[model samples]
Target: MTSSDPHAPHCHNVPGDKSAVQPDKKRLVSRLNRIEGQVRGIARMVDEDRYCVDILTQLGAIRAALDGVAMQLLENHANGCVAKAIGAGNGEDAIAELMDVVRKLKS
Candidate 1:
């Protein structure tokens, strides 16, 4: 799971206390559950033989919703983990990590 890119910055610093990352986990799980429901609803639509255009529209909505959730998680990571890393003198590494994710998202 580790990136081998030489230019990729790495973080070996973890929160001294695990509780610091708990909220991110909780929010991620909650968002994923909502996405799961959306997926199941789409499946039901298919079973009901919904119109192709309607199904495609719903799929687009699901994608946008998932992207919204992703943005929220990224914001949280920036404010929490990245901020902490910067405060601890690892700002370059943190920024690099964020940039890498942004690049991945773009692709």
Candidate 2:
């Protein structure tokens, strides 16, 4: 049976070409590497029984860093993938997918 949900079986619009050209691959990788290091640092802090407040602060920083990465990725999607889909007359699905991710990011 068909469902209204974009994620429903038979309604999914996964792109055939999974590898979209990423102009900022290097920058994104660099940021992710730093975030990974920060995560490891937080793990160490937890193991050392660090102050709760300090650990909380570090957690907040990591969330912000992750949000920054999300924003960059969203921008890249809008400028590259979404734009291409629009040009190809498949913008409706593209935009729906974009909005879905946007709602997720806001949460």
Candidate 3:
């Protein structure tokens, strides 16, 4: 998905070429792995018949952690892809793509 927020500034302005933006794919993957572990821990808690409130708390934490990952990714996209596109005179498209992403996140 994409966005259409033309006036919304990104973290960094990059070229339109996505290949030019060097993303820390390894770091992202590692974070995701940790989140997976959290999920497994929650499952184990359930099997142990943990308190409902405790399980719910853990679930909330997991959601927050996932949101953190999403924010990081969004920052990277803004600094890399969105920035590049705007610099390359494709700002409209970039903004539209970002808006689409924001919409999905909100939903």
Candidate 4:
């Protein structure tokens, strides 16, 4: 499913171009900013000798946040690059590439 929000991830360029997909640039930047802050907080926690469980919990959160980012990018790719390729009469190749990407993501 694609997001309707203009701030959602998507490419502003013409479809089928070699350029990278950029869903909402601002949203991505914001997410990365938060993730960076989380990393710094984790570092501080470690330096302060915080509880092992607390640190582990924060680590898990970080991993989940990163996964969310990946999912957004994947969605953008499918909606932009893959869809454009299919429309450009390269559906078979695009599907194959997308499958490979899914496999890698799963692994």
The top-ranked prediction according to lDDT is 4
Tens digits of per-residue lDDT, candidate 1, 9-106, equal 23346646432343446666888898899999999999999998999999999999889876876776676667668878888988998899989887
Q: What are the per-model C-alpha RMSD values against the true structure?
A: 8.8, 9.2, 7.1, 3.8
Off by over 4 Å in 2: 1-14
Backbone steric clashes in candidate 2, count: 0
lDDT of 4 by residue, 46-80 (tens): 99999999999999999999989888888777877
What TM-score do all the candidates reach, one by one? 0.72, 0.84, 0.74, 0.78
Residue 98 accuracy (lDDT) in model 3: 87
State each model's CA lDDT, in order. Answer: 0.73, 0.77, 0.75, 0.78
- Tens-place lDDT per residue, model 3, 1-107, is 22343322233443453342225666778989999999999999999999999999999999999999888777777766676677678889889988999999987
Q: Give candidate 2's error at residue 26 in angstroms.
A: 0.5
Query: Clash number for every model?
Result: 0, 0, 16, 4
Greater-TM-score candidate between 1 and 4 = 4
User: What is the Cα-based lDDT of residue 90 in candidate 4?
Assistant: 79
State the lDDT at 32 in candidate 4: 91
| Candidate 1 minimal-lDDT segment of 10 residues | 1-10
- Tens-digit per-residue lDDT, 1-107, candidate 2: 12222222222235673555456677789999999999999999999999999999999999999999888878777766676667668999889989999998897
